[model samples]
Target chain A: MFATKLKTQLLLITILPLLLTIAVVSLFILFDVLDSIESEVIKRGDSITDQAAVMAEFPLYTGDVDALQEVADLLIKTHDLNYIRFVDVSGQLLLTENNGNDKGRLREFSSPVFSQAPDLDDFSAPAAVRAPLGSVDIGFTDNSAEAQRFSAYIKVLSIALVALALGLLLVYLFSRRLNEAISSLMTTAERLEQKDFTARVEENGSGELRNFQRTFNDVIASLEQNDAELQQKINAATASLNESVEQLSEKNQALAQQRQETIDLERSKAILEERERIMRDMHDGIGGQLVASLAMLEREQDSAVKENIHAMLTESLNDLRLIIHSLSMQNNVLASLLADFKYRTSRRLEPLDIELDWLVAPEADSLSIKPQTGLHLLRILQEAFTNILKHSGAGEIRFRAGQQQEDFLIEIEDNGEFHPDTEAMSRGLGIRNMKSRAEKLGGSLNIEKISSGGCRLILTFPATP
Target chain B: MTRLLAVFFLLLTVLSPVHAGSVHIVLSADSDSHLQAASDIKAELEQQDAPPPVTVRLLKPFQSFQPAADDLLVTVGEAATRYVSQSYSEHSQLYSYINHMALPEPQAKHWASVMLDQPLQTLLDSAVDIVEGRYHNKLVIAVSEENQSMRLQIDQLTIPDSVELEVLVIEAEAEPAKIIDQALFNAGALIALRDSRIWSGETAKWMLYQSYKYNVPVVGYSQSFLKAGALVSVYASLRDIAHTTAQQIIGWQNNQGRLTQEGILYPRLSIDYNKNIARALNIPLPESMTAGEQNNVRD
Candidate 1:
């Protein structure tokens, strides 16, 4: 299957009819001209016959063979005759003249010759009366007709071929221009298919093709404008959608933050209410026992047993005061609470033969402490000071408090004679009580023997606790 | 009163016969030949024993002229014949010098013709005289296809002495030379009838030439044949036409303008001979033939 392009097909459609019409018209013209020439030649042949017959009449009447021969020769020479003959009524040849050429077709005409002036008064009239003396037979050659036909054929064929070639050239030129225009339009259409709206074609050629090119360009322009407007609309819609999403995300985050804050506020309120209940329970139960024991012991003095009892009762009362102070401190500032504990501790240490070293950081002033956590830290501190007084036998005590990596560090040291391998010291109630208080506050208390013959106790916990 | 009325009616009847007895000749002549023939007919009519009071009306084309009732119309030539036959058919018309007569309706009885051409009998009789009783009874007459009616009339002739009439029919598209050659074969004498196709142009010369070749004589219808080597020619002269036409009128007049079977008659004719042709053929003339019978001779 051979493929035909639009241009070739259009050229074929235009050229075939033109060529066929030229061929048909040429054929018709050739045939008509040939027919007309043949008829005229035949008419010429008949005219020659008539002329020769008239000239031969007097010669035949008088039986003048020389005159008849002269007339025949003259006719053969004057016209394009192949042969001329004069035959009498008895089929006798009287005179004949021929050109000795018979290659082409022949046209023959025969006419009778008679005496026009027969003597009506003479009874002995000649025998050329009621019969033709002789008939002139003239033969004309058709070479001219043949030559004319050949010439006409050649002329017609030449004209037909020229016309056909000219028609094809015109068709080809027209089709080529048309195809170029169409190709441009097709290329534009392909570009438009690929979403490129800026494609255009030149408005070349004439008439409808030019109009089509202009129309296609206009359509592409309209499409480009529409595409730009559409892109703008899409960008606006995307921007609005992004803004809506961002606003929604921000609102969701704020709502979660507020919900978390509300939960923290509820938890803090519950913790404060629990701490007040614990303080009331402690004041009503253990606070009355401490005050009664002290009063009883003050009346029994002067004996060694009674003096020992009085000292123990005074220490128990101080210990109970310390617990109350740690539980009752309000403002929740660790540094201020530590300052009050230091005043009491320094007063107790003054009655002994030891000097207290206090080191508290200013960062502690902004640190907040829970009430239960404060009580646990105060118990651990008191146990350490009491042990220093009763068991350390050191001359001075050093206490330090500061923040260490998100935790509060407290250190207490004493200058005393110490032993590392004493099971009694590890199992002692005083040291165990300090360890229990440390565990309760989510902190660790460590005791180490100092190289300078004193013992060190360290406490560490988160500052917020 | 009845006897007196009868006598007055009888007188009127007798007076009407006297006026109606006068013969009226309505002459419609259109050509010089017809005018001459008309005068000849008039002169011949005046010589009658009882000539009628004649009325000569020379009519022109498309002109209407009514003839008196009971008058005889002398229509000369074809134009006169056409006018009187088409216009005044109720009157009795006697046509003369008409080369061809149109036949009237079989029921209509007023039309008759005196033919301008000699009758077939006259031509045949002249043909027999030229034969001089030689070659027994063979006579060949050639007629063209158009004049087959003349051949039919010739067939009705009462030929004498068991004469065999060989008719040579000339076809419309035949070669004249071939027909003439065929007509002259084995014939005592040839009669070339007056036919446009068989005796026109060079045909007359061809016929005479063929007759000379066959050593036969041809008796034709025109005196031109005598000069053209025919043995004899029999043709009706204008005087003969006038004399025959007058005779027909007299016959009709004697019978009170009533047309008769003799109304159609052949005109008298003159005979011409070519003496040189007869001598060349070596044919003998009849002893009773006189110089008076020889109207003209071309040596």
Candidate 2:
């Protein structure tokens, strides 16, 4: 009962005071009305007794019983008297008229019957001048007072009920509106639990309810701000992670390519070292023995078998030197290999009393060349040199290498006796080998007779092949 | 010479009495009773020689007359008294023979009355003397509306010791038996004042009979009341009223137009008792219970 709903509490708060006020006022009015009614009854009874005393004065004084009876009967009929009795001073009951039945409710009023006119100057003054010849007693009832009290009770109770009802109605309406406002706030809170920061409650109530709505909205706005900041942070972190992943992939790819390039470099270095070692062995052992043998054969002078053996040893050593030079120079630049070839051929030509010219462009020196292409170019160059040393017997040779439009250019020219059948010499194994080496280098080889030379050789390929 | 001067002063004193106004004696009728009382009053006033010359008028044949302010109008009997007091209320008048005249109807200061009833003092004295040897308890004084003045007059008088006076005031239209029954309660003797309303032929007989039935002796105002079964009677006759009226006129003349006392005045009292009635009640009458004036007391 004490912790009832808001509506019932409001109803009680509004109606209890109204009921209390009505009850207190009704009690006050009822008591006042009863007092007034009793006063009127007393005044009326006193007045009736006074009148009866006056009327019975003459009859009682003269001992007129019939006249007194008449007066008493007249009083009972006219006024609200229940009964009236005239008793003489001698205690004689001269006349009486008793009409009332309810003796318990009757109020008796008595007045003195004097023979002479009394002094009425003071109404409350004692009748000192005239003694009572007799006295008249009149009886009355309080029916009207009771009826008035009953009527007042009904009216007061009705007013109290009406006021209570009106007050309760007003309180109920106010509390209902308050409850609805709170319910709206409850729903908004539910939506907030679902992370719907856009949800809002209507801020329409009094006092605490209004404050609650404002606070709820404020909290939701704060949450929305926090949510937006958190979402931005998440997106930023994801983007940063993606960028980091992409950078890591790129770095991994670069690292793998570097590893492969290192492996290729190692392999190429090993092959180049092996080829150098072979080139050294050939130059120290086989090439020197062959040269000594060829010199011994020259000292034999005019022996047919010794001249044949010297020719065989020189050819075999040249071939073995050519193979070693190709292997050793496989990873070198075209210009560097060409310079090496020029030095080697120039040394050989000095012994043979031939002058060699080597020319290479500085711009062509930076041109990268693959190992296979360098090897192929070296073999081709060897073939050309061998042709110069064995067939042309040219005293001096000239070599040049530089950049053309998008390719490297190499040319070799030597002075030698020209033969009509030199073109037919391309069909020979040595010329064919030179042509094949140029093709393998993705270049063209051409042999032409120079005007002041024995023969001309040209080779062209891409600069960084 | 001193004796002769004294005689001369005495003769001058007798001849030099002051006189004022005419004295007119009006009688109700030429009946012996009224005429004799009228003549006696006239002679008494004339012997005093203190007022104007006296004149007598009998009202049996009804004469119309007017009186001056200082003229003395002496009325005898009830009819002549009411007529003169009513008609000539402004004149100095003396009224007698009337039992009760209602104070002259709005009252005149110049009018004085000599009642035929005895004064309360004389009646009480006579009652005390009569009931001296008897075993008495309480004295009852009763009156009707017509005799209301006697009640007032008796109330001012002191009653004898050893007697409780119960004053009963009766109305005019009362039942005599009922009034007598209330008045005679524990009464040793009853004093009944004369009133035409109560002492009428029928009610008077009824009251006397009721008093006798209650074994209470009654003192009445007139001899007729005595004859109606009352034990004693004390009253003033017309002649006595006339003599008292004359003395009042002389006193008024001496007092410069003011009566010696205000209101109506009564004559010297006389006592009369019915011996037969007293014997019937088994009560002895006093030796002084005579029929004529025994005391000159007047009020």
Candidate 3:
């Protein structure tokens, strides 16, 4: 990647010398100007010296050495001749200048300018030769005079350099700032991509950058708002799903109750079967013994003994059959199947002067067709009706049998003068027998007082007929 | 404030000898010392004798002798203009077209009308730095080392105003024969110089000064002026005349003594007793002047 950049650098280096050539040419021009000016000055000085030397030689050769020396002294003392001397044929100085400390120029002239006389071959000085002659050496130093000419040049260069440096520095700083901003933008964009819009770009100083920062912050704020709204929606959806789950759980509980009812029916049926076997055995064995005893008594021709034997056999048979029916030896039976059970119950109750109303709907026949269901139902009805004849005082008894959906509903309601909730009220064995029978048959029976005042029995069983 | 003004002027008097009250200063370069001395002497005549109203001109470093319009010449002809402007607001600083350097180019142009068209003295820095940043004059001190005898030694070297040798037959003036001989010799030298064409008429003028004038010196007659301490034929009588005839010395001395910067001022003397003619003449030392031994130019 850098090879091309390196090539560009090399190209720049190659071009730099050509650019510097312009500076060199400018310097050459300056040198030429100085040389020309100096030459002009020197030429003018030489001419003046020649003319002045001619005019001054008048006092030299009159043979008055004092005056000759005076002329020489005048020449030396004059402002121009800075260093001039009158050296005779024998090389004796007449006069010269004396600057005590600043001898730098005199020292150079002392080397060869004085001794390298123009007429080296002319060693002879004739008696009439002119004297007090001065030679001229000149140069120009007008730097202060020309100072204005250079001011603009120097100012231009100084200002240009300053401007360039300032411009370059500011540009470089600005570019660096821009690069940093771009880099930060990229980092923010990546974070934004990750949904971390909360991280904000901090802008520094004044400029468009601050605006960009504010805009970015606003964008993040909008995103946060959106995030909140989306979260609220999600929460609402979750609540709805939870409610659905609760409804399903409630339905499952109901289903479980039905299953349990079925299970109970099977268990109660097994218990009823065991009880029926026991009762049958008792009838066969115990009833035969009693009968035999009775027969024996008859053969002796003893009327008192025969009568006792016959009474014992009859009571034992009746108690054993009641035990068998109370065992609830039935399966999958409906409680409402005991439709004619009420007729039978009232018939038993009539000699006792007990009133019983046993009512069953036409639909109750469906429940009664199942003998297992009818058997348990008839037992409960018989017990309740017997209880009404034996215990309840001045009572009107009601037995209702119907089908409510798949359930057999049986209710035994009684209106009796005896207190319904009083512990002092006698509960006959027949009522207990009725309640036990209903429970063993996988059904429930409740005794409640009606608003009109009386006991009411509500019995419910699965209509599995 | 008044006293301060007095002190400022006093300092100015001390630093500058010729303070032309209303005239702007002009400095020009002159390579001819003799002519410059004559010119200076003439100018001082007016400066010293004139009253307070007289304005003096301050000629700058190494003034030229044969300037197209010498300061004194311009003064004599009244060719000088006074630049007494009421205000200097309009004048811009002077600028040279050559080497670039800043100058305190005050508005002397507007303040002072164009006085003369002569080249002014080189700018202050220009004049002072003309000698390759070195002293332009050689210090040739020739001291007479003997009490009765004129011994060969240089004590101090003084810059001369002008130097020449002029010869006249003061005693031989009545003798046409002697004058003719001298004139023929001088004239022959001129003709010979022209024939050779090597030395121009300028050289002929120098020859005339060397041969006849015993006062002014010949140009480049001898090269060993510094080494021999004093050149030959430089009369001892010259020293006495300088003492007696130096009427313009005060103004010149004052100018020389006044300085704006600190500098060591040594006595300016030029010849040594060792020169053959100086010893031959047996010149006496001034009562106030001290005699000394020769000093090395190297020193």
Name every residue pair that clashes in candidate 2: A354-A395, A415-A453, A415-A454, A416-A454
What is candidate 1's TM-score against the reference? 0.42
lDDT of 3 by residue, A1-465 (tens): 343543344434443443354355444655555565555545544543443343333433233356655654554445344444433334555444432334223211221112112231111222332223333222223343245335535654565556555655655565566556655666777788898857777665248876887788789889988998998999999999999899888888878887887787677566556666676776677766766765766676657656776666655654444444434334223432242344445565677676767567876444423444455566666565555555555457776777788777878777764356445333555556666767777778776677556667788877664
Q: Rank the candidates by lDDT, best first.
A: 1, 2, 3
Candidate 1: lDDT of A337? 78
lDDT at A155, model 3: 52
Candidate 1 chain B minimal-lDDT segment of 10 residues: B99-108
Give the range of the ten consecutive residues with the poorest summed lDDT in model 1 chain A. Answer: A120-129
**Regions more than 4 Å wrong, model 3:** A1-161, A168-191, A195-356, A360-384, A391-397, A401-465, B1-193, B197-299
lDDT of 2 by residue, A353-405 (tens): 88878778997667767656766777788778877787776777788888888
lDDT, model 2, position A356: 72
Most accurate candidate by lDDT: 1
- Residue A447, model 3: lDDT of 69
TM-score of each: 0.42, 0.33, 0.32
For every model shown, the clashing-pair count is: 18, 4, 105
Between prediction 1 and prediction 2, which has the larger DockQ? 1
Per-residue lDDT of model 1, residues A1-465, tens digit only: 242766556666777688778878988988888888888887887788788877777568656799888887888788967898888877888878889988888878888875554443211122443546678898877888888888988988888888888877877777777878877887888899999998989776579889878888998999999999999999999999999999999999999998888888788677656765766766666666766776776776578887788777677767666666776646367887788889888887888868988999988989988666777777788778877887778889888999998788999888887666569867777778887888877788898988898899999887764
Note the chain A TM-score of all models in turn.
0.53, 0.47, 0.37
- Give the DockQ of candidate 3: 0.01
Once fitted onto the true fold, the runs of candidate 2 whose alpha carbons sit more than 4 angstroms away are: A1-465, B1-20, B29-31, B46-52, B58-63, B105-109, B132-134, B145-148, B171-173, B182-186, B250-262, B287-299
